[model samples]
Target chain A: MIEIQTDPLLYRVQKPEVRERFEALKQRPVVLSVQNLYKTFESQTGTVTALKDVSFDVYRREFMCVIGPSGCGKSTLIRILAGLESSSDGKVLLDGNPVTGPGPDRGMVFQSYTLFPWLTVKQNVMFGPRMSGKRGTSAESEARQWIDLVGLSKFENSYPHQLSGGMKQRVAIARALANRPRILLMDEPFGALDAQTRCQMQSYLLQIWRNLDITILFITHDLDEAAFLADRILVLKANPGEVNEIIEVPVPRPRSAAQFITPEFIATKYRIDQLIHPDQGSPEDALPFPRMTPQGDDVE
Target chain B: MLTMFSFSLPLLAWCAVSYLPFLWHPDVELQISADREGVTTVYTPGDRVSEEFFPEFEAAVRTQNEEVSPFMSLDKPVEAGSESSVRRSNKKVLRHLAPLLVSNGWLTEEQTKDDAAIYVAWKEIATGARLPEQPALTEENLEIVRKNWALMSRYSDSYNADNFVSRPLLSLVPQGRPANPDYLPAPHRVLISGFKEFTKPAEAERPSMWQRVGHSMRIVFGGFLLAALVGVPIGVICGTYSFFSKLIEPFTDFFRYMPAPTFSTLLVVIFLANDAPKMALVFIGTIFQLILVVANTTRRLELPLLEAAQTLGANQAQLLTRVVIPGILPNLYNDLRILLGWAWTWLVIAELVGVKSGLTEFIETQGRWRNFDSVYPVIILIGLIGFFTDQILSFIRGFIFPWTSEGPAITSTPVAKVLLFVPRWFKSAVDERIPYQPESTSPNKA
Candidate 1:
């Protein structure tokens, strides 16, 4: 076995101010709690563990991000929290009550486009309330307000197919918020968008969170995304996924694009990167292809 | 321009085969006909025979005329006992000239039935008083007509049944023009015959063309509505739940493979000789396919939509009605449109069974008599009805499911504007009842 040295600068140590802020956040009422969560799948190859002994807590009005590698069960955890999937061994509590199945209290937005193609933006936003037995006029007005909040009032009568990808996701966000859920569970909701749109959406999401009295559990694979918006980040390990660390982001509040270059933001992103890519190094030495380039013609 | 060419190409091809005689005219249609001695086969002026057989027919009539001339010129012309029989034969010969007289426009159709009028027309033609222009008499036929009239005038100045039988009349030689066989009537002939048939008054035993068309429409629509009524709900259930899908789809898949028409005999026996059996055949033909198609369309609905609805507090019943139904409706409408066309394929086979009703029945009867002109009209009518119905349905689909991106947006043509009136009015009416008024333009601040 080869020995590897850990990067001393990126070590898992919380500064005094960050710890104090975290302590203050914990004093608020818990909105969601997960205890010893486990999920497994039965396949032809035999049973495979997808998640193992995961635990976490989210306070009221908290903005939490779960960041991990591809197979780290980030989706499975979000699904279980949203009551879209059942855990093999765990308990999920929302406001001290057990999470049984999906309800209006936990609004979900998927990574894939999920807006009903047959309904206009306004109608899609009205759907949740309508299903809960709210009549037309009330539902319509509430839907209109939500549409306005998402900055999509002009497109309220447009179908999903007519909207661009980012606009569609915004409509989806408005649709979810219309239900007045206690918490929003977003599973990489901007993952499919372009880089520019993704940044815009991150800012839009942060603004929405600031305005509303709502808690959010956002899942992403991008370290920059988590560091930019999250109050705290939950990092997990792959291969029977388990929690690696819960970092209280050292970045200042009211985040802007200018703060992305700050030392605290860089340190938080570096810690997530180290956790997700612990074996990271140059991969060229592992490749079997023989070098065919002329001497001293380096690209780096 | 392409649409015009699509229809005109076939019509142009038909015209080529019809009016351009040099293309393919294997037979000769008779303009004037004759009777053969000792042969009972009577050829009419419009009857067609093979090109090779026309000369033999003409020769036979000429031979019979030669054999009769010598007997008539003899001094002792007749026997009293057989004079009536001779007069009867002469009367038959004069009646043969009736068709020729009508074609020349000298005699009306009803006047052809009057024996005295036919006698006068033949006298005028022989005397060169009335000239037939459209189909001028050949020199040989005119000579035969004069000889026959000379023999007839010797017996009577006007038609007298007793005097008309005094001697035998010479038959006109057969003459003809190159023509196609009777089964493939010319396009103009078909148009003329079709017009007459449609305008003809209904008789005691026969229904008019319009009635037959109405009957056919009833069968197709009745069967389709019934299938949609029953199949949509079952298909939706099958599509929604795995338990129902497994329970129903396997058998339906199996049943769809068995041809619908194969059950026609059974339907006829069960329903007993009326419209019921025909409608039942169409229903059976359509329902199995409808259920399978609708179920598949329902299955194709993306899973994300359902999951999203579930997370938004939709219960099982709510998921089906609000999410599943609305999600599959555009595709379902499209499927039903195609299946309605499928149902029409059964119409011909369905109407053929159990008492033979509708336009197909008319086609069958006219085709049996080799009246192909009449048959073409009914067959074309069925095709036109199916084509226009499908086109209109496709046009209306854009209005019914406006959210779908598959078809063109509704245009502002006069017909489209008229069709849009009802839906627009209904939407405005609904809008009025809802008291909430949204801001016309809300600025986006995010």
Candidate 2:
């Protein structure tokens, strides 16, 4: 755990009430907690246990990121939570209620842009709301709001074919948000984006969080992305994916892209790098999925 | 001698096949029976128009003699000799159909009316001569206009004014032609004029040419429309859902390979009991082909589109409606383009089974009496009309899906942002991920 710099945005934030509410919101208990979760798939080749006993707790307004190397169960865990894939073992608690199936209360944003090709952007966004039995003026208003929130106001009437990749992804994000889920699950949501667009989306995501403060459980293979948007980063190891360590990131609120250049940022990055690649320092650090050595254990 | 050899081959083959143990005898002689009111003639060979529609054929001969005798001949272009009635009537139809299609977006509207003047002045020797270029219209637009004129001219030649009103000998001599003892043309409908005993049709039997063409064209067109209507929705459904795709695909695949004649046979047996067997046959044939189209379209729902729909919090029903159906339009249009021929292939088979109507039955009638000449032209009419129907449907596809042509042409590869070093696959991946907004890029994020 590193002590974080004061959130740079705290100085510029003009609302005193928001600042007070933010602190009060931090005091709220964890709404959903995932503990010692594990998942394995039985394929034709053999049983591939993709996730090992992973643990994390998400409080309201917290934005947590699960980052690891490829083949680590970051996406698998998200999929399990999304109800797309069943977990071999473990339970997910949403507001202390066990998640037995997918519900509108837990919105998931996929990495791929999965818009209905025929539907215009507004209709695609309206889809979930309509299915949930929300209709007429209320549905239309909510659809318009979300479309604008994703910054797709101009493209609301355009078909998916007419939109670019970024626009499609934005509509996906808006669709998820329109559900107003208590927990937002994003599985490497920006991994497919270009470097520039990924940063833009990240900032937009952060801004939206600042407004709505929904609990976030994001999975990423990129360390920089994990560091930028994550409140706490959980690193996982490959080969029967398991969480190695839960690193607390104390970087102040409202960090910008420029903050990545700070010395402290580099130091934290080096430490994470050391955990992922132990040969950079001592061999003893190479233990899989992190088990702390007993007090007097010798370093190899 | 060559004609005799050409005509006898099929008859010989049929006779040999009929004798084989497994093969059945086909005594299918085509015949046209007559009513007291209308004339009937046996098949023969001087000309098809003259033999098939007797009174109309005779009328055409008389009209041609009176209308195109000395000056109004088809020998020269309108520009070459004196522009005559033969040329003028054809030019009128050509100009009318061309502008009609262009105004309706079936053809490209000319940017300038200069094309009309150019077409009016066309000649064989001077077909490529440069004309006045005083307008601000682009050369490309002019080229399109000029090509349109050439099309109009080509069509203008095909509809000879003298041939439009042919009178057949059948209607002229409904009682039957008198046998010329010296020229015993067993085929029928020949008047050795001075022989008072020659066959002549009762005065009431003659019908108009336009009426017959109108009737046949309606049936042909109705069959085309039935295929389009039934096939398009099935295509949309199969394209939209994996479940529908799973259920519909195998059967459609199996049926498509089965010879269309088999379906026609089955259809003839079942539909022969129906009140309107011709309509039923068209329905059966169209449905068979449409089912295939639906299945093929199911296979082309854009991959990204499916993924995108799932990401949108879409449940099963929404998934089917939004992502699956619309993504496969291009594929559907293409499948219909292919299946149109299949439906029409069965058109002949279906029509041939005990049908007294349609060109197929008419051709069969000519065949029974050895009217080889009439049969060939009817067969040619079938092919030409099928081709024409395909063109019309393809035109409709173009109008509905304008992006289809432009898409594969202009969008296969976009201009690269960096020099050639960037891998195309990598670029495509980036293109998929990145949001398109110029503002989304943070000033220094790149």
Candidate 3:
């Protein structure tokens, strides 16, 4: 039971009358709500606040991409949501139930090749269902379906080491999807791939999401990647990372490389780049936070 | 020619030492006499019984039975050059001792009577007191004469009395010559003639070398199987759970540092002195060290693999069975191969403890008998078996874990080709766990 919103944008950007009329339609129900999240990292030098008062909501079947510069805690937020790491405070709710830890309900694909090196491509995909106590012909078929969906039917018997990096990531995706999770969390899944392979992977991932009707929360540092793939792009500012903006993509879906040169795509990419780098063209531009602060100045 | 010389250097050294005395005094023959009691004396040809060394034999007779002691009750004194008097008294002594020496098979009656007179005559020539009509004793005959003296001295009924002498061999010549029955035989003789014993049935008192080797192999296999079965699971559990590791590590570590042989007393208290103690020795020798090695290998498992398994919804039991065990298997197998070799070092120590019947005991007994003809081959056999076992383990490891850096050895031989089939069997074994899925009728369907 998903409620569809006629107005895809969360916040209105057009005329007041038109925006009000569009908002009168049904709004999509939230699939995941992350609220008041904070994460702090302690080290020998001092305590570093990685994420502070971060909050976001992803709707059902929504393709949400989180973009940030290095050290912005975008990866940390997704990891906390995946339950691989714990949040210092606040909760991540999926289907209105709090995620306590990593479970079958949430599947993750890491940037590294996380496919089981000891198992074959088919065996890696089958690992989830087999561990969940589903076996025999049914589990085999489910694993095979995902492997084929990832365009790896021919390499089913090959080990992870034998496959290329992109193929390994594809197997990882299939392995995550074999559990039939409600949400797929990808942490820079295509970041390790070459340019051509990354583009292909982005398109294939889009196709999979459309066909399976699965919600996805992708973490990336690439501006064009977020602009082209996300229904909404969440941009974060660094140094105790905070949410700067969430821009809704107005471009039509079923997108491809032809849309890469479109003005709308270029405008969204520029806007995200500006938000991440507020003082884009100024020579005096530096980190918003002072490089060296006085002793005992707002340590938290 | 150079290769032959390189191999013959030791043989040449032995020859030079053996012939050195003859080079010094070509006319004389030196006879060395030895026996089970370890009494030894060197006798030269033409030396009389009074001049030769049999003082212990004389003392033994005087203490054992005074009435029969010729040295105690001689009618004529045996002066150095008094041939007639010495011969007369020696003949009487020979007559009195012939029946006893004959009963013990030490000397024949003719040897005692005629040989005793000849020895007296040779004594005059040896000391330059008289000229012989013709030379009667040569190097070969002198050896027989020395043998006669050794037999007489050893078989004397009172030889074990306080008069006993412990004499090591006269090593003016190199040792280990077949001519000296007490010396170890040459290496070639051991490998050739010693191997002939395996072609026939074994005796009741001592089995053949092959049979002893079989027994040792069985014991090693039993101990290795038990250690692998018990140690591997404990190691896996210990590695998986930090608390279990903490509980088991202190004791295993402490015992590993202590000598494994020190446990023989406890083994004896728990089990009978038979094969149980022997097998327990081999087991105890390796199990503690193996547990530590395997536990370390498991602890060093890649963290990302475990995290991937967790994200894949693996329970604790599934994680252990599917991921952890397989992850550490290749390294564990390498650890096992090394430990099996270490177990061989303990094999001798283990078999030597109680009711010894293995190759080590065989070697020990043969060494005591001065039969290196049998002892050397058994040692070589143990080395050969250990070497081949290591090769087989390496091949099996390569076969099972092909993904590991230890790839199978490449060859075109028929045996290698047949061994290549072994991986198929391993694949089938694993196929039961992750069943093979056939290709879908349609290749690309989302």
Fnat, model by model in order, equals 0.73, 0.25, 0.45
Models sorted by DockQ, best on top: 1, 3, 2
The per-prediction CA RMSD against the true structure, in angstroms, equals 5.1, 23.1, 12.2
Candidate 1 global TM-score: 0.84
Winner by DockQ between candidate 2 and candidate 1: 1
Q: Comparing chain B with the reference, what is the TM-score for each candidate?
A: 0.84, 0.41, 0.60
lDDT tens digits by residue: candidate 2, A23-135: 56467888777878888788999988898897777888888888777788788888778666677788888889887766677777788766665567888788767767777
Q: For candidate 1, write residues A1-300 as lDDT tens digits.
A: 243333435424667776788889999999999999999999999998999999999998999999998999999999999888999998999999999988889999999999998899998998898898987675687688888888998999899988999999999999898888889999999999999999999999999899888899999999999999899999999988999999888787899999987777787887788788889754455667766768889644
**Alpha-carbon lDDT, every model:** 0.87, 0.59, 0.71
Q: In model 1, how well does chain A match by TM-score?
A: 0.91
Quote the positional error of residue B275 for candidate 1 in Å: 3.3
Q: What tier of docking accuracy does candidate 3 attain?
A: acceptable
Better of 1 and 2 by lDDT: 1
lDDT of 3 by residue, B1-446 (tens): 99799758976765554445433222222122222123455332222232222445334333433322243222434345554443343334233333333433445656656544444433333344543223223343333334334434443323232332122111111111113222434456765855675565788987766788788988888888899899999988899899999999899999998888888878877887887888898899889998898899999988778877887888778888899998888888889999999888888888877677688887888789667677767777888899899988886665567566434343334676686678768887887887656665432233
Show model 2 residue runs off by greater than 4 Å.
Answer: A1-27, A280-300, B1-257, B263-266, B273-289, B299-315, B321-323, B326-330, B365-446
Ranked by TM-score, top first: 1, 3, 2
Model 1 per-residue lDDT at B211: 89
Query: What ranges in model 3 sit over 4 Å off?
Result: A1-26, A41-47, A249-252, A258-300, B1-81, B84-190, B197-200, B368-373, B402-405, B408-446
Rank order (by lDDT, best first): 1, 3, 2
Rounded to one decimal, what is candidate 3's iRMSD? Answer: 4.2
lDDT of 3 at B221: 82
